[model samples]
Target: MRAIELKNVSKIYKNGVKALAGVSLTVKQGEFIAVMGQSGSGKSTLLQIAGLLDDCTSGQIIINGNGVSRLNKNVLADIRMKSLGFVFQSFHLDTHLKAYENIMVPMLINAEYKNKSAMKERAIQLAETVGLTNRIEHYPGELSGGEQQRVAIARALANNPDFILADEPTGNLDSKNEIIIFEELKRLSISGKGVLVVSHNDAVKDYADRVLTMKDGILEHTDEK
Candidate 1:
């Protein structure tokens, strides 16, 4: 029953350009929702707002039934850290860290792990979940595009969050890797994680429970597949 809900959300930049207009959505646990659109169509903006990485200019955001529109930055930060996981198109792994080390980054500040040993164990488990056990000690520079993305996915799962918000998660990969990433995401949703993916690829439709299209700052249509 846990869900992130956006009620009539709108975002307008300081330059007077509107990125979203009266958009409303709900992403619940065990659901895979894909938002597809052309570039500049506000899909990324929608994901950022939903993930609490950016605030909407107007309207309400509710996470797990608690309204978060008025919460302070620190509280919002805590909620984001504990409740949501994020994966980006650009694998944001630290260049200086090994694959397992990168996965452990999020657990460093989390209250769940009391010591480094526990964090490392969880990181190893996550690496295994993403099929990166053999590459856990490798650096990002040493991995292929698919491998780096797998590392990013492992890092996102490090905190054991309820929801995963991914923005163009397979943008840098070829077709094979794209399918791999999508399958991983679909598997995560089946494992009881709410997944919202913003992607340009139509292949995502094959794996999504629902597909929403964005056009010119509006949610143009929704197709339940």
Candidate 2:
């Protein structure tokens, strides 16, 4: 049971703004957890800390049963690269690169693939997984919002990470695309990936195994739907 846990985590910025206060959570592989909140309620901050993109001001962060709150930057980077995947609302794809090429970007830094051919194969497989096989050669600028977002999701899985942290993944899309993105994320969780999504949309609650609410830096469990 691989899991990421935050034990009594707290974050205080240099300007004395407390973004999180004693927030604790545990997300395990094959589980889908959704966190919903209003803007400025610390949801994004919580995702950043859990994803290892930002440091918490106090408390512990445990990944796969090891406390990693104090690990050095390089080691943290290595762990983040190998163990975690991330998706963002903006669909951070390279405008100049084709869909499959953008998906291959993360594999470039990973030492698991020995050559470009293997990376390309993996990228193609991921493109197929996300239903982008037909658009593999299209650039980001040429794809629809939903298609671009699917490419971003495939790129996130390029490294075959165990956990995914997504922040407002469907913020820029229509209702149809929102459901599409949520369904894709839900499918990923069923495939043994721990998924933690920070979203403002209530529709996510329907797909998540657990739903939590954030209010003024505090986390509260919501009744199961």
Candidate 3:
């Protein structure tokens, strides 16, 4: 399935700074795509627009067949909750919540997981999948950076999203942990989920099925492993 399609997408700030300019990209199911660029290169902007966390200044965002560039905020929120998953450079976990509880957040908001007990069970399963089985009861601060990132990965998969959008997901990790995380994402893609990663980390190229380079707000074809 076509997970996401960005057609002539552009994003211009109010001050007239164009973060993205006529950028187009496509991500399909079971594909792992990596985007590389330096700071201020619009890599993050492209991710935000694609994930529906922000809107494009001009053009269309087709996510899983629905054009969402023009969708209302509520509709966009629904799509975000149901179809897309996100991981960030900073593991954005709630400080006080336990690892498994953090994973349950999305489930709580999702209509399908109305039963609290079932939601917790699913969260535990995700935690195990991310190698956090024993740490499921720990808080974010109690975990190491890698462990926290793993929890973040589990949380991202909580809603069983069609695509996972990761923005510099391994920016804070050590070399060893970076490999671990990248391998996990690669495995996720192999299992049929679309994974889009925007990172400057060289380690990512080894695991990506396709790598794209963004320069000065435009995406250019690039080499991959």
List the candidate 1 regions with Cα displacement exceeding 4 Å: none
Tens-place lDDT per residue, model 2, 1-225, is 599999999999899999999999999999999999899999999999999999999989999987897689999998898889999999989999999999999999988777999899999999999998899999999999999999999999988899999999999999999999999999999999999999999989989999999998999976446
TM-score of each: 0.98, 0.98, 0.98
Q: Which stretches of candidate 2 lie over 4 Å from their true place?
A: none
Candidate 1 global CA lDDT score? 0.93
Off by over 4 Å in 3: none
Cα-based lDDT at residue 153, candidate 2: 91
Question: What's the residue-level lDDT of 173 in candidate 3?
Answer: 94
Ten consecutive residues with minimal summed lDDT in candidate 3? 216-225
Q: Write the per-residue lDDT of candidate 1 for residues 55-154, one digit (tens) a residue.
A: 8999999999999988999999999988999999999889999999999999998877789998998899999999988999999999999999999998
